[model samples]
Target chain A: MAKEKTSALHENKGVSQPKDTNTRAIKNIRTKRNTKLNTKALVASILKSDTVALSRAITLIESNHPSHIKQANAIIKACLPYANQSIRIGVTGVPGVGKSTFIEAFGKYLTSKGKRVAVLAIDPSSSLSKGSILGDKTRMEALVKDEHAFIRPSSSGDSLGGVARKTRESIILCEAAGFDVIIIETVGVGQSETTVHSMVDFFLLLKLAGAGDELQGIKRGIMEMADAVVINKADGDTLKHAQLAKVEFNKALQLYPIKASRWKPKVMLCSALQNEGIDSVWKLISDYIAITSKNHYFEKKRQEQNKFWLIQTIETQLKSHFFNRPDIKKELEQQLELIKANETTPFAAADYLLNL
Target chain B: MAKEKTSALHENKGVSQPKDTNTRAIKNIRTKRNTKLNTKALVASILKSDTVALSRAITLIESNHPSHIKQANAIIKACLPYANQSIRIGVTGVPGVGKSTFIEAFGKYLTSKGKRVAVLAIDPSSSLSKGSILGDKTRMEALVKDEHAFIRPSSSGDSLGGVARKTRESIILCEAAGFDVIIIETVGVGQSETTVHSMVDFFLLLKLAGAGDELQGIKRGIMEMADAVVINKADGDTLKHAQLAKVEFNKALQLYPIKASRWKPKVMLCSALQNEGIDSVWKLISDYIAITSKNHYFEKKRQEQNKFWLIQTIETQLKSHFFNRPDIKKELEQQLELIKANETTPFAAADYLLNL
Candidate 1:
């Protein structure tokens, strides 16, 4: 078995380490001088565009060890001043929607345009799915070999917040390492897409033309969040259906109010298998960047995202602290039962439990 | 102005009291036994179908007074056994889509069917506006007079969670008072609709026939949250447009994935002013209840809502505690500045502020 097999389900995988490591990670890092020195070396290496050092820093960020996480925060802080120079795009789709192939083609096209691209994944399912992103990295065989493109597999975790936080910090490391474009790929499971959407400048949804696509495409308001929807596999017999989907999505997109960015979302066709329409996807994103930059929405959104993550971080930690307690676990079940029996209100139950 | 003016923003009408009353309300309620006697009396009156008692109980729940909140929790606990007997329906739309009239007609219609109804509002805007729900009660004058109907204006609070918690607790008091149906009305603002949606069984979106309604109706993913969309003002000049809108909405609703309840959302046309198609709206809800109940989704959803509220209460309180700290408020500003200047990551800033 491959070394990545550890993150997979031994029985079924997703039970990765950490009954209570999220806040523990933050707590262990409290203004340690030793952490800053090691972080300095990591930061120096990353600023020199050494992907090896970037990967190592991210490993520290993903580690369950308290000391590693301590150094990780320091590394992130040191990398911060050299970051924020890349365009972060989030790509998402349901399984079998060809997300990996689509990104591989898109990343290759950007690299051809002299842009150094870094691809990262935020798949919460990967923990249970036998190193899914590592598998994807190998699938992007051609792009992986390109010096201008770097692909890192997602960190395995059961917590979407923990996974997302790791990926978010990784973007900084990638940026400081001179990656001009960062593509954050996530599978269409749970709230992963929304998590990615919040962390990215552009959110692109890849869709197959048919095969119950219309039924699931609009689930959870994913359609509303799309800055652009690219109908992938728009080659051969599927080409006609893909065009129809574009028209349908175009009409559907107009029903939404103008986004705060005041930039209209567009739909395009692609065939990553045929490597067709990849450049148009890049063109669409470039146009989005141009318009949003001109309107100042780009910078404003990034600032708001910063504030969102700050609060988000604290909230996630708060929940972890409250929930990871052994006492609260038993008390919560009792409260839930009291709720089901209508013997206690959820508010009242929560008050009791929180106080307890 | 009415007595409700006290809740209105003196500056413009929506800034009701509570510099810090949410968690404070809960903290003051801990393990107090003296509260039970007053609550026992209140619960007795409510079970006897006394609207005045029900209103008073809700007032206690809405009060920022520590003793009032303690007594309120007892009242809710006493009322719990009699609650869960009502079908909660959330009605929402942008202002001027005739929600007040629609609910008035709908409430009156249900009363005519020999169903006791309680109408409650959850307008977070009431804190800024001059007694909006109080004004709405007047618009619902006929229903207000119906012995079979009870109306309580929304509690005033800028915190949607606080206002929502008050309304949720009020539902128990209403149910204990023998109301068979509860209508939760909210104005489209911020996340009020979504807040209302989380607490209801049937989420209805009211839409005007035309006038840029399509653009704003779907804003913030509200359309996806609806279990049904009713086209209002379908009488006289607007009737044709309303019919057209019904068709369009029907098409749009079909595009969404089937709800977890496995129920397909319906679109209907209504003219509350003319009382046209009011019975059909009831029929639609009846059909929904029959199907969801048969599938066990109705009870399952209610149970899930119980758990959701339990967690929501804790999460809201957690955020309130963190953000309300004077130190956190100042520190957060500095941290955000650090983030914008790229001197630190949001996660790093969050850790620092949380520690401080």
Candidate 2:
């Protein structure tokens, strides 16, 4: 399978056929080194909140080599006892919303208060660009320099489902590493926000004050999932607009149905640049945790999210396995075209492909 | 599978064991007879607007008999040439919103205009009740008695996913049967409305004049999917409230981003009992069709729907097949317990089960 991917890579560079020499050699070295890592030692180090071991363990989870499966499973199982001790927060906003700056401010405040924070991103689109918002050191310099904060960009070169699975597993490792707070960052452009929302304890959506695209962000289906909506860059000239935006958002949210959690989603104003109102944001999260925990919704939500990811992971794997079949791939395009042309019904097409 | 389901049904009576006698006898006769149904004749009759043949064909699509697969595929293939000729509309509302009355009035109006209209419901909850809104003669008396209209309740004994597939296939059959307008009805609760929206060209949401559950409908993710919102029961004392609702909904919709079709969703007041504003509703549909068809959105939407259903059906089947395994089922409960106890991560548990 690795060789096939390698060949496909070469073909994309105008090579009609793959020369498996260099790719095979590099892949063999990586596989050997990955398999040689001691799982017990890694788990022990991770339990001590060792960042190096945590990175290695996450690498094992992201590895596609067949040999890494048992090792990855062993490490995760060993770390499972220490997991789920942290709050998982999902933060998202569109580009130009100062998401990285807000995250940096948020992380700095948590670390200053003697908290360990781990930040992970789930950006499937990063595979194409080789660049990520959190990956940029200049953007989150304060968090990057903070000893108690660990910021990891998205794992590139994988489908969103694959990245989601890896990120979810990484959360377990982060929790086991004694990180009291875990923030999952996502670009609020597409379906990734929903995926992140399902895996987190609280979902926060960032919006720009006085932006015309406020409704556009809501149209993407992120607003309803939000636990809080923060209007960023609320310093200096944007202060008035930010306050008005907060009021407008508060009114807009009332039009939505009451959430099952029975917790009212708050709209807040924040300026990451000035580091203003960051404490209020933290207070909101703390209040939510206190109230929901008292009502038993906090624990209930975690269990539900666990079950959701379990089913979601299995379904994603099943689909990929089916579509990866050589015969099915050979026939899929033709069947899709037939369906588009209305020459065959989608059911008939699916039946044909399944039977094939 | 049919035999298994039948035996399970009998076992539910506390018989403790299955006697294959009556179940097998009934199943064998039905399977053999259904397998022998002439596909060409069925298509010929359906193309000539025979509701009886259309109902029989829908039964084929809904059947669990293994022998019916090829016959069902043949019928759908034969009918494909005549499908996609009708305008598909999805209508939904919460219970007690007078959905059936509105649909009945809407269907009657279309049929009275010399158009053949087909009404199908996609209510999975109706399976347990053995009665459906569309099945009520008193509610839809006019449409039930109209010669130009064909009304069918939902197929029973299936999950929502299964029911959706059947409903989608039924739409094709109805379109092929010379129905100029096809209305797919769904309860305005849960995920069924999303399913209906994906398969239809236009989505209509029905709301009552003074219901406090207006936001409740939006919370279910139905409001955003609506191409039009109809404030039903706009007569007498409710007229003012209905007009107010129309204005409110129109304002609410303006906060949403422009739809991909670029067609602005409209809000209108109607009295199904008084049979007023029905023509205006029809005019809206006609105008929408004319504009979207001119811009080629109608064709583009159908093709996208075909592709969506194909992928959706395949994914649902894959999940069911995997979870249906007895061993997987047994392990699933244990794993879920472990997950709830925080003894295992969802990804790790999924890996363990998938490897099993």
Q: Let me know the DockQ for model 1.
A: 0.55
Candidate 2 chain A: worst 10 consecutive residues by lDDT? A4-13
Candidate 2: where are CA atoms >4 Å away?
A1-49, A56-74, A94-101, A140-142, A205-224, A228-297, A337-343, B1-77, B94-113, B207-221, B230-250, B267-276, B337-344
For each of the candidates, give the backbone clash count: 11, 0
| RMSD list, candidates in order | 13.0, 11.9
Candidate 1 residues A178-233, lDDT tens each?
99999999878888999999999999998889943563435658988999999999
Q: Residue pairs in steric clash, candidate 2?
A: none
What is the DockQ of the complex in model 2? Answer: 0.54
Tell me the tens digit of each residue's lDDT in model 2 across B1-356.
Answer: 45554643364445567767789889988866755667778888999999999988898888978656678777887888878889999998889888888888889889888999999999867777856656666778878889899998888767888888888888888988999999999886668888899989999998887843345436545667888998899999989888878878888888777988889999998999899998999999899999999999999998888888888888877888899999999999999999887778788788889999
Candidate lDDT values, in order: 0.86, 0.86
DockQ of each: 0.55, 0.54
Compared with the true structure, the alpha-carbon lDDT of candidate 1 equals 0.86
- Every model: iRMSD: 1.6, 1.9
Query: Which stretch of 10 consecutive residues in model 1 chain B shows the poorest summed lDDT?
Result: B211-220
Per-candidate TM-score against the hidden true structure: 0.77, 0.79
